[model samples]
Target chain A: SAVISQKPSRDICQRGTSLTIQCQVDSQVTMMFWYRQQPGQSLTLIATANQGSEATYESGFVIDKFPISRPNLTFSTLTVSNMSPEDSSIYLCSVYSPRQGGYTFGSGTRLTVV
Target chain B: AQSVTQLDSQVPVFEEAPVELRCNYSSSVSVYLFWYVQYPNQGLQLLLKYLSGSTLVESINGFEAEFNKSQTSFHLRKPSVHISDTAEYFCAVDQAGTALIFGKGTTLSVSS
Candidate 1:
């Protein structure tokens, strides 16, 4: 299984600010996905990070609001732009390893926008 | 696309007691079922999965689930649980070559 190191674990930010979450995979992955889990809610897909190309965002997500960068096979970053209190949630990056038969998720970034 | 349903939002059980967490999913295509456990302040860990072959799958930590195609259910069960088993359990489904769709999750509270 591929290990994903995601930071900063958690952060408290003021409204109208931006935060970027990074996930570095120990090995190359077939696919990388970014998800947001609202308080007391299930995980929702934000976007799929594609290497060397623009990320594919989900229906409710937009490039301006949630921009994703996939610089290489093992690295990806997701930025929440112009965040508000509603944007507060746990952001997680997940990677699918073919050999593992499942996805490996990062520890997640708990962002609290006040 | 697939959608998962976890009937119980929370389950309280005594330590060393048997427990079951019900999960049901709907998908038009062939789908894979998986159970994941998330501890407090941590990421999800794959507990078990039903990719193919036998309908029964077991995790290393004594948790097992049966994939029932007719019922569209993959309920997790443990004959005996410990306090360490307390956590949020999520049931997810993925169509072949697609992203996973997760259920709302069930919080299991194992008390002494």
Candidate 2:
């Protein structure tokens, strides 16, 4: 199975600030997804990051609010722009691995906006 | 489109007791089912999945889930649970070449 290393496991930020979460996969994968799990809520897909292309954002999400960068096959980053208290949530990255026969998720970044 | 439903928000049980976490899903196309466990302040770990073949799938641990197509259900069960089994369980569904859709997780609390 592929291992994903996500940084900034948690953070406390002030409103109007920005935070960029990163995920580095041990193995190269074609597609990587970003998800946000609000407190006491289910996981919601934010965007899909494909190498060498602009990410495809979900309906409720926008490029200006949540910009994704997929520089290469094994690396991706998601930035929460102009954070607000409502933006506080646990963000996770995932990759579908054929060898593992399922999706592998990162440890997740917990953001708290005040 | 696909969606998952976890009937229980929380399940409390004593150690060594039998437990079941119910899950149901709806999808127009053929889909895959997965059960994931997330410990406190940690990431999600794949518990088990039913991709094809037999309807029953078991994890390395005691947890098992049976895929029922007619009922559109994939409920997880363990004959005997341990205190270590305490965690949030999530049921997710995914169609071929698509992203996964997750259910609102169920938190399992196991005590002595």
Worst 10 residues of 2 chain B by lDDT: B93-102
Per-residue lDDT tens digits for candidate 2, residues A27-74, read 999989999999878899999889999999888999999999999999
Question: Which has the greatest lDDT?
Answer: 2
How well is each residue in B1-112 modelled by candidate 2, as lDDT tens digits? 6899999999999999999999999998789999999888777888999899999999999899999999999999999999999999999998863688899999999999
Q: List-wise, what DockQ does each model earn? A: 0.63, 0.71
Per-residue lDDT of candidate 1, residues B18-41 (tens digit): 999999999887888899998887
- Tell me the lDDT of candidate 2: 0.93
Q: Residue B67, candidate 2: how far off, in angstroms?
A: 0.8
lDDT of 1 at A106: 93
What is the fnat value (0 to 1) for candidate 1? 0.41
